[model samples]
Target: MSRIGKKAVPVPAGVTAEIAGQAVNVKGPKGALSFVVHDLVAVDQSAEGIAVKPRDETKLARSLWGMSRTMIANLVTGVSKGFERKLEINGVGYKAALNGKVLTLSLGYSHDVLFPVPEGIVIQVLGAKSDQIIVSGIDKQQVGQVAAEIREWRGPEPYKGKGVKYAEEKIFRKEGKKK
Candidate 1:
């Protein structure tokens, strides 16, 4: 019943996929990743591509069908190309610097905030002014989580729109004092 579930996931040319029972392992140019499919859904690989379907007609099985298929797709994409997220800091004295595995942030605070980078992820500070930060990893979820954690230290304010925010994010500025 799910459109996304019915669609087969085509494995790219450079990627290798191995299915062992409910676990699927994928290896590609970027890296290797693995995921376990839920029991409610079934996975099959054919000459055409990888197919996912519900094991039964029950509601839970149907709900997991699409989700399982998407998970496999994500795994393939992640190992093949990896993922990256970019954030920009706005405001005077707001910048980021990378020292070894530590990221130092100056966001108008009296003291600099030091963040330790995690394994399997790379954080780079770009821009001549140090306003740009790039987070990259083979795992899409890990890349997003690291980026969100860095942004959480100083989110953009509605009034001034000054803070760390996604590179493509747009902040809705609020009107200042009406006096």
Candidate 2:
């Protein structure tokens, strides 16, 4: 039996959860999100909360039991409190700005990088130097993807330890040449 799947996901106040067939819909103050659970696992909502059970004692069903429940939990949390990701830019002349829905980045390249912001995601530039970025959205995956795309513009280097990275991320440094 999966430990995580055994525990019921309690729906918080002001959040509503509805299970229709294999799909679960979660609506809250933040927004609304739905997920279609896999066929191997069955999901249901009771007074206790949401419960997930496998139809049969099979390997695939057992493996997916916990994941399905977690996905549902994430949906509930996302629709309520939402999610956020922070990014930091290093090195001189490295900065970022938001013009309308587009994110313009200066990462020491010959030309500036222009990233169009997609729907359901918001980007904010922080600090006087504009070296910090905050990506927020109700969808966990979308926020993470946007942060990752921004970091990809100029990843940190081992020697100089300069470039874009997550706020809590640490970069391992390497020694420079003796000469």
Tens-digit lDDT track of model 2 for 1-179: 89999999999999999999999999999999999999989998999899999989999999999999999999988988999999999999999999999999999999999999999998999999999999999999899999999999899999998999999999999999996
Native-to-model Cα distance after best TM-score fit, residue 144 in candidate 2, in Å: 0.9
The superposed Cα distance between candidate 2 and the true structure at residue 79, in angstroms, equals 0.8
Give residue 167's error in model 1 in angstroms: 1.0
Residue 26 of model 1, lDDT score: 92
RMSD to the native, candidate 1?
1.0
Q: Which tens-of-lDDT digit does each residue in 1-179 have in candidate 1?
A: 99999999999999999889999899999889999999988888997678998989999999999988998999998888888999999999899999999999999888999999999899989998999999998888899999999999999999988999999999999998876
Overall lDDT per candidate, in order of appearance: 0.92, 0.94
RMSD of each: 1.0, 0.8
TM-score, one value per model: 0.96, 0.97
Error of 1 at 80 (Å): 0.8
